[model samples]
Target: MTAEGKILPIVIHGDPVLHNRASEVEEINDDIRQLVADMHVTQEAARGVGLAAPQVGAGLRIFTWEFEHTGDAPTKGEVLNPVLTLLGKVSQEDPDPDSETEGCLSVPALGYPLKRSAHVRLQGFDVDGKLIDFEAHDWFARILQHEFDHLNATLYVNRLNPRWSKRWKKELRKQGWTTAGNTWMPGDDEDPFGHDAEAANEAEES
Candidate 1:
């Protein structure tokens, strides 16, 4: 949730900002600082791992994830901003390739199996701008890719194989996907933010 305690709205498939590249964050100013904190609170409240600024309707290169919080949030957590993330030098060959199922807060109900590097070393800072480093394997590396995609206006949906894509379409339709092109519908899951569930309702109505 945001500082106002209203849950931050999530920009889903049809949102324009989710398709265009995000702007680079120029300064770690108070607004940017507040963004990281807001993303953390919002993501936790939404039960998400990592969230980018674009997901929250900001067209800037800011995202937050907790290396420590695998599933729980606020319970034990540190919210990070990528501005100071070092993403250390791990050569292409240094990390092994692995595939795993992945999902997004932006595209709920449709998770697809995708490949990613098995390990990573990242340097960044928490919401307070305190320096932090993240060394992770498997799922954690996947988290890095997921969060980074938000900066580039990419979604895990783009990574789905043809087989997975077909399966996703069928299932998402069952979950109420109405947009004919590249779009997704909110599943039966609870949406803390009103937009997704409302979108789902609208899709079904039309």
Candidate 2:
């Protein structure tokens, strides 16, 4: 983390910032660099593998990720205005429920299954405005796709099949998250997921 980095409040699902498409970073300057740095701190505080600018209430097309697969060197960095290309034909069928489960910081604790391309190519500029291009597979690819969707104003729940989507929407309503301007500060707030017995059972059934 940079010396100026601070953990910013993570916006919740109801926030308009998470629903609208993010703007491209017009220039990589101190503000943009500091935003990325703060995002890294916020992601670490939330114990998340990936986080997008919208999640931090910034409508900028930026995201940061840090993951270390077993036996592989850690992959960690931030990208601005990323463009993703699926490597092959994507499946229309719903992904296996047992696998491909994903959770979002913006959505708090709820996780759902969604299909994603196993391989993808992502191109973007780093914080310093240098171009970055690379291909990723498996979990790395999934992370990129998730963040890319944020830039386009598509949440993972919005991509779920009808049944799950309905359930997720209902749950969101039940939780009173249908409005904008909601946020949660990591460490300061109680566990947002609140994994109580009933909540766990509800998730299992959903």
User: Whole-model Cα lDDT per candidate?
Assistant: 0.63, 0.86
Writing each residue's lDDT as its tens digit, candidate 1 over 1-206 gives 23332346676665778878888666667786666676777776676777788888888877776655343223233434453232444333322223367778877655677766656555555556567565656566668778877778788777666777787777656755344234322233465346566778899999
Which ranges of candidate 1 are over 4 A from the true structure? 1-6, 67-99, 124-133, 169-206
* Candidate 1 local lDDT, residue 185: 23
- Best by TM-score, which number? 2
Off by over 4 Å in 2: 1-3, 70-74, 193-206
Question: Roughly what TM-score does model 2 have, to 2 decimal places?
Answer: 0.88
Candidate 2 weakest lDDT stretch, 10 residues: 190-199
* Residue 147 CA displacement from its true place in model 1, Å: 0.7
Clashing pairs in 2: none
